[model samples]
Target: MPKMVFIETDGTRREVDAPLGLSILEVARRHDIDLEGACEGSLACSTCHVVVAPEWYDLLPDAQEDEEDMLDLAFGLTKTSRLGCQIRITPELDGLTVKLPGAK
Candidate 1:
């Protein structure tokens, strides 16, 4: 199993196991973290927006155009901003870190 660290808006960090292939959003929701995937994993919304750690951001696959369009609506977009739903936990991301943007 892979693992990941989540940095909350208040600066708290929590680490959790991420089953291979599960999206960051799933791990957050499973652990009761504050992220809100309002559209489930449908990619229809940007409610699961997260800022990937700079070092880890490059390891993720490029975002699709649709996800990019939705990211445009994210509350605090950044160079590493991504839809948590679109990032799967692969072996390369065993210790991934991402920060949850402050609440809208």
Candidate 2:
């Protein structure tokens, strides 16, 4: 089992062990992390935006055009920002930290 760390908008941290290949949004929803998936991972809404820890940013896949388009609508876009719904968890991403962005 692989695990990832989710730092909620209110500063609460949760470590969830999950199988690989599930999106980060799925993991957060499973653990009740309050990550809004307004578009249900469709790459349509920016509601599931989150900031990947700087150290783990390079390890993840590059954001696609649609993800970038949606990110532009996020409330607190940052250099380390990414769409949680677009990030699939993997063993290589274990220990990765994602900060839930403020709601739109």
Best by TM-score: 1
Q: What is the lDDT of candidate 2?
A: 0.88
Q: Counting only residues 3 or more apart in sequence or on different chains, how many pairs clash (N, Cα, C under 3 Å) in candidate 2?
A: 0
Models 1 onward score TM values of 0.96, 0.94
> What digit string (tens of lDDT, one per residue) describes model 2 on residues 1-104?
88888887678888988669999889988888888899899988998999999999999989999999999999889999999989988889988888887522
Q: Per-residue lDDT for 67 in model 1?
A: 98
Candidate 2: the clashing residue pairs are: none
**Which pairs, if any, clash in model 1?**
none
Candidate 1 lDDT over 41-78, as tens digits, reads 89899999999999999999999999999999999899
Clash totals, every prediction: 0, 0
Worst 10 residues of 2 by lDDT: 95-104
Q: What is the lDDT, from 0 to 100, of the residue 36 in candidate 2?
A: 88
